[model samples]
Target: MPTPTEIRLKRAERLLEVAFDDGSRFRLPAEYLRVESPSAEVQGHGPGQKVLVSGRREVGILRLEPVGHYAIRIAFDDLHDSGIYSWDYLHRLGTEQAERWAAYEQALAEKGLSRDPPRRRGG
Candidate 1:
């Protein structure tokens, strides 16, 4: 398992860049992280109780609060400030981004949901 050495938020790109001591780097999109948060509100108290969060297409990072040396708390512009994103958790999320995103997309598809609003061209 890789340990994070530093974390930087690129506000303009809406991405969180994490550098691990093992020379690994992950650039996670803010929207992705916000939707996949590990908070109880999203994960619930059991295995099959995870909530599918929608309407996060416009969510942005409001703040990143360090929790000692192990974790950091992310505050979203949508008022989701409960999830404490630990280094290990963040690493896992980064590592599993593709698979997780696929699953999320699949779930959304099954539920007739979309990640973003429809785009209008030349408007």
Candidate 2:
């Protein structure tokens, strides 16, 4: 498996830029990473249990912590921090971004969902 040689967090762009040892580079959007989280809440315990996450268009990473030597534990502004994105998984998400994003959008449209969450009343 190709490991990341560099991982940069582009705060202004809300992107995670990863450069692998294989000379492959990917700029993964915050929304994409949030929706495609590898947590049980998102991925579930078995196949076909994948949950389609919505209302995260403006989500941003709060921080990213290294999980051992294999993965990254991302804390998103939405308070979601369960997913542990591994090297291979991250790479796959980057490479298949287009198809996955299109599928996500289609699913949301079918479910009458929106990327931006509903506005809340005065607290």
Candidate 3:
């Protein structure tokens, strides 16, 4: 497996650029990362329990924390920071962006969810 040589978070664009040692590079959106998070909250404890996260089109990454030598913890602006994105997983996400995103959108549509966050009343 190719290891990541650099990871750049473009705050303005809400994009995460990952470059691997094998000359393969990918630019992933923050919304994609958040919805497809590898955390239990998103992936669930076992098979067939994955949560379809929605309303994150405007979500931005707050910070990236190193998790030892294998992964980094992404703290999203929405306050989700539990997912520890490993090198392998990030690569997988980058490579599988299209299929995964399509699936996510389909799932959301099936459940009647929107990419836009719900509007507030008083605030």
Clash totals, every prediction? 0, 0, 0
lDDT of candidates 1 onward, in order = 0.89, 0.94, 0.95
Writing each residue's lDDT as its tens digit, candidate 3 over 10-66 gives 999998999999899999999999998999999999999999898999999999999
What ordering of candidates by lDDT runs from best to worst?
3, 2, 1
Candidate 2 structure quality by residue, lDDT tens digits, 27-118: 99999999999999999999999998989989999899999999999999999999999999999998899999999999999999999988
Runs with alpha carbons beyond 4 Å of true place in candidate 2: none
lDDT of 2: 0.94
Considering TM-score, where higher is better, how would the candidates rank from best to worst? Answer: 3, 2, 1
TM-score of 2: 0.96
How do the residues 1-123 of candidate 1 rate in per-residue lDDT, one tens digit apiece? 677888999988888999998887999998899888989999999999999987677778989999998899999888899999988899999889999999999999999988884566895
Model 1 C-alpha RMSD to native:
3.4
Q: Model 3, which residues run further than 4 Å from truth?
A: none
Residue 70 error for model 3, in Å? 1.1
Q: Pick the candidate with the highest TM-score.
A: 3
Candidate 1 TM-score over all chains jointly? 0.91
Give candidate 1's whole-model lDDT.
0.89
Candidate 1, residue 86: CA error in Å? 0.9
